[model samples]
Target: MKNEELRIKKSGFWLLASGFWLLASGFWLLASGFYILASGFWLLASGFWLLPPTFILHYPLLIIHC
Candidate 1:
């Protein structure tokens, strides 16, 4: 039905948004990891502080597998 189609569309939009957010967060983590690895203790400490909350926020979205 039309309502069902609308619901599906809405869900699709949400999925796409979630995917974008996850990708962004992943890139952030990767860049942070590399900075941590390449640089000395200060960069490593900063990267550690910054990356975890991003990972934690996106962990459930990553599990979505969509």
Candidate 2:
């Protein structure tokens, strides 16, 4: 009974540890996902902001060609 109790306690400890790590990894993934999404939006916004300057610089070329 002593050995069985010890084994059960060890199993419980492992279960708790695994659960903690699982929760930690879940939060890490969520944070990274949010970061990726935010960076995607930032890149999209920056692309739009660059368009006007690009168009202005190339406006004469476009008009001459047209």
How high is each candidate's TM-score? 0.55, 0.76
Candidate 2 C-alpha lDDT tens digits along 2-52: 999999999999999999999999999999999999999999889878888
Shift in Å, residue 22, candidate 2: 0.7
Task: State each model's CA lDDT, in order.
Answer: 0.89, 0.95
> TM-score of the candidate numbered 2?
0.76
lDDT of 1 by residue, 1-66 (tens): 999999999999999999999999999999999887778877767876878788867868999966
Top lDDT model: 2
